[model samples]
Target chain A: MKKLKRSARLVEMTQYLLSRPHTLIPLTTFADRYGAAKSSISEDLVIIKEVFEDEGMGELQTHAGAAGGVKFIPKMPKDQALIFAEELCRQLQQKDRVLPGGYLYMSDLLGQPSLMNEAGKIFATAFADQEIDVVMTVETKGIPLAYATGAQLNLPVVLVRRDHQVTEGSAVSINYVSGSHKSIHTMSLSRRALKEKSKVLIVDDFMKAGGTIQGMVDLLAEFDAEVAGVGVLVESGEVESEERLLRDYVSLATLAGVDSKSKEINVKPGNYFSK
Target chain B: MKKLKRSARLVEMTQYLLSRPHTLIPLTTFADRYGAAKSSISEDLVIIKEVFEDEGMGELQTHAGAAGGVKFIPKMPKDQALIFAEELCRQLQQKDRVLPGGYLYMSDLLGQPSLMNEAGKIFATAFADQEIDVVMTVETKGIPLAYATGAQLNLPVVLVRRDHQVTEGSAVSINYVSGSHKSIHTMSLSRRALKEKSKVLIVDDFMKAGGTIQGMVDLLAEFDAEVAGVGVLVESGEVESEERLLRDYVSLATLAGVDSKSKEINVKPGNYFSK
Candidate 1:
């Protein structure tokens, strides 16, 4: 059989793996395709896997079962998830984060990849173990995180716009008093966004008053889909009422209170990975 | 004709604008359709505009031009983008962020809504002035930021999954060496993910060697798509590479270096939100 050296072989292996997210491909097939021995292919896989593993690149899951082979989990460990959350929280505490209304200045972080990546990990871990069919977030603020968690899990993310669209054609919208705003807000998901009985994980950037959160909760009820978990970038513990109904929440930062002046911000550890 | 109170009014307004991202809509339309007076519609639009604008909920663009009225830009200011990038950078600096072999721990922030929302804003700012037809990210890590940025611009995110599944009828693939490991990796995009001349922005969670980024870049060439910009969650600066040519980049943290033993890690900010 023709043989290729380390560099050439490694590229072929990764390219093959990259094309497939989580499905397992046996060693025998790879060996034949690469025109290398099974042992050689095995060795190459080890080298490639180790390099990627060290770099937090997508994973290579090897199964020993008769039908088992190598599969990529595309995952990051739990510890990795927490370190990221804590780091973002620290940055959020800086004096410059003080917005005009005492809100944490988060524009930079939101536009950044490091913080976004870490946040993705936290939510991914939150839903990592859950058998989720789709990742859902209300339109606007929640779309980015929802898409990230969905990517990590190899699931499709559906955006629930606050209003219906011509493309959606039909939708189910519910009016609920925002947990934070105390004023009513409408939350909606298109008829095509989801299917019945989907195990969903709901995520958003912030939960102030949670009118949107509860609105999503109510929207989920409309579809009869199970809420697998609820996660947010930041959670306001100050919001009154409706706290008991939440299950499986992960917040990177908890705003105890943004001082009246907005200059002094108090933050506590969030529910993310704290459990 | 008939009218709704503030809460109901805001929800309805938010829903309408979100459905038509990057498209212009006249205020008179909302006024006439809601059966409310133009003055009442103006008040509602003002409130809708303020909430999304103040909170970075979304961009509200009001064009007084003869051809325009009120259009949501789906964007926020640059200063806000910088704040988020800095916040994420500070967060990634924690000691606990250390992983095996001097690697930094990540993945949490990438998936978080808070961070992703910030990341999305940054990209929206970059492309806010550009006309992007679609947002593209290779499957897995880049998905969240890609989706978030896409939503902010009101564009549909297209994923370039590894394999050609039944759902993805056909695809184009490319091969490139991963910057991190010097291993060749194949990257792919579904044939239907985008169209020719589609303005694409490539986003990912991390950029160690940028091999994956390069692969995706090369992959886009296969589809005849133009890359408007390239964005990443985190980038490693200290590391040398033989990766593809890159035009633009946004990352939370850029690794400075590691101690001789790969301990005592150091990181500097990437070009994210550099005014």
Candidate 2:
């Protein structure tokens, strides 16, 4: 409420923009709040913009005219994303993470907030240009990543439950064959969770044969929602071409091969780098 | 990184501190990064600290002497928290949210990233003084809230699953009786998820008879962990005194009552305000 000097105002403005990403705030709003001239506010934004780019924090897009102002878009530089993916690959290559039946034990990595936040930033950057109304993920493991990306994109997250809970009210349920096992499984989404004809971005922690993703895509059709994009933390590189259920998606890492007997695991940076 | 001016350095410093909450960053690090004297970095922090408080963003705690620097503690002011709780109550009071057996449909609210971020800040402030090593919550609904709090606290989150999955490897499971149902239920946590004797903060989306919270508490004991604090977004006000399982906890809102016949619901701010 009180008029602050430029130094104090810059600190406050930076934090405000960081907190509320993807939302436009008019210059008048900041000008009135700080009791500063429009030109002064514009100058302050230019300084913030330069630092943001140099630090790899993100972008501050400015718009002109009465109805336009500025919007913060969270993004991770390609080199920084590669560094993160490489670190993740190293973590995944640990022999002990290989569970029975070739399942990689990554719950620990997923549980770490810093790691999840970095992963979220990458996903947010990958889908930064898409018109996504919501980020959707299946229940349990993927919830955190979905929430993290949603937070970055300033979008609501919609969760699909494996078993419909009574607490969610009326729900639409569908059965799809699992990619690996070829067994039928049901996934449900609350009717109220998503609006009709929304452009939805699908995200997941891991993908094998892309069956679960396909299931989600099929489920989205029930709501009359369009698939804007799909992103995954890891994908099974060993899946046969005929077995793969989905094709278009971005992955941070690929599980190339798992030698259970030899306790050898191979993890490579996903298609993200190649793209 | 190249040397930046005071204005540019201030912007970078604020964003750095905000991104890495609870972690200590020495002044020398900033001084070295910007090729500035420690005194300059200290002065910049002063401006950041003042603006952080004035804007009700959070606290920037500075420690003096060698091996000391500043730490950012994310917090939501009391008035802002109350406003958030009131808004949550209004949303929860919608008649259609009441399901059979008095269950409330809150998945939509929980799915929203902005709301969850606000709730996380409130919980982080409530237990800001506690020495918490990790944030814990049971499977499914509580995962998002737990992750959000963990992100704010800059701590790892451990999820206790209802059913142990093979992907989690070896797990430590315990059976606890439901406080209201008087029935036994199994809650499992991965043996690798938590360190022994860790100080943990428990969070959940909703609490009824406190059975689930109690279950988590009992489960924590299996890992030789200590319960630093417990936080819930909403607690059932209708639970009888004799049925209450836990009394020492914080709640953002209270579901006072629900009239299924008239489709009317009663809601109030939780005990967070009373304290």
Candidate 3:
């Protein structure tokens, strides 16, 4: 690589850090790549740190000594997260999104990368302090959200399948009754998908009676994995307290109520704000 | 944003452009954003553009005249893409990945966000010139890849489910024969997921006999959508030419052959390099 001027170097360095989040890069690596002095690299980092904070683009943590360097931690500011949640609620409140059984048509929102990225950042920020080994989610809808959050945290995403696929080799399948309909459903996970005793964060697109989440929690026990946290895009606010399958979970939006007869729906920011 | 200095402004602008790929932003927008003159914003973009090109982080396309700004087109250089494909092949060639019926265990690779991001960038670059409105993929495995590609292209992703769910409302389901086994399989897409005559880019995790890809193409016909392109992460080389259902597509890696008895597998870079 040719030696670049300070301006060019800054732009490259910023992109590099943004692309590889949660990974430490020593100062010597950058110094050698740019053929710049260690002191100059330090000064450049300081500028990046200030701008990163000013723009709310997470923190650029710096470590001193020979073995230490810098790491980028993606985070969403509380106020910004609230704004996003509010916006999501507004989108969710649309009457057309309400299905026959009170299900929201959120596939459009989940499909948008920009929106998913924001949600991912919020989840990453919420679990930033936790020791999470991997992000877990059920097959289908939650895959994108899980991947986005995993990208932000620089962690691998492990998917739990609805049905056992032959390609996955050996697997563990468990049946649990759905909290909403009291129907039995089976969820499976590849033996290779997760390691025993790993700390996992569960994410999902929607939570109706919290049955699906509970199933995941129970399934994790088979792998001897610990559930570090659970995050959902939307949760059913009408679920009775006693019927709720899970108690501790984070939600971005709440489906307060819906009037199928009048085609009216109500949504509010989830417990994320209160937390 | 507060009036940041030139250095800070550059950092902020870089991050902003990177996040919103393929979206046009006028110079005045940036000028107003930073409370700086258009001339200054133009200068900042020049630095960003230079670094973006030099670092192979895609192109910063600038449009002149009123109502014109810049668009970030995510791309992967040919050399870098080859290197990525080679790495993927090495990973796929592991004997342990070979399952009964010649399926490869690639969930671990697909679960890694960094790897998916790279594959996404490569697909984005390959189809950058195409006028694509949305990215389409099947449920479960292909969702992440589709989402990553959609993120790069700044487009929405539409997932075609194997089984219809009540939450999806009215859906269109079609049965297609598996090209390899001639077995019938069902795929469903929500009526609301796609628009009529929309240009779609189909992406998938793996392709064998191209049966699934063909199914998606046929399913798009129901929506009156056009298949602009098809991209797959891995394609089976063992599929005889006479059995191939589709030929026009791009693949990142090729599963050349697998010897289940000896626990030996062969993999190579896909058609992407040849093209």
- In the order shown, the candidates' DockQ scores are 0.03, 0.88, 0.86
- Ordered list by lDDT, greatest first: 2, 3, 1
lDDT of 2 by residue, B1-275 (tens): 57989998889999999989889999988999999998999999999999988778889999988989999999889999999999999999999888877778888899998899899989999999999999999988988889889989999999899989999988998888877678898989988889999999999998989998999998888888999999999999998998999999999999999987777899999999999
Q: Interface Cα RMSD for all candidates?
A: 24.2, 0.9, 0.9
Estimate the lDDT of model 1. Answer: 0.66
TM-scores of chain A across candidates: 0.85, 0.98, 0.98
Say which prediction, candidate 1 or candidate 3, comes out ahead on DockQ: 3
lDDT of 3 at A178: 90
Tell me the spans in candidate 2 whose CA falls farther than 4 Å from its real position. Answer: none
C-alpha positional error of residue A74 in candidate 1 after TM-score superposition, expressed in Å = 3.2
Residues A164-199, candidate 3, lDDT per residue (tens digit)? 999898999999889989999999999999999999
Task: Give the clashing pairs for model 3.
Answer: none
Candidate 1 chain B: worst-modelled 10 consecutive residues by lDDT: B161-170
- Per-residue lDDT, model 1, residue B202, is 79
Please list the residue runs of candidate 3 whose C-alpha ends up more than 4 Å from where it truly belongs after superposition: none
Q: Per-candidate TM vs. native?
A: 0.50, 0.98, 0.99
Looking at candidate 1, what is the lDDT of residue A71? 78
Task: Please give the distance, in angstroms, between residue A271's alpha carbon in candidate 1 and its true position after superposition.
Answer: 1.7
State the displacement of the C-alpha of residue A75, model 1, in Å, after optimal TM-score superposition.
3.3
Ranking of models by DockQ: 2, 3, 1
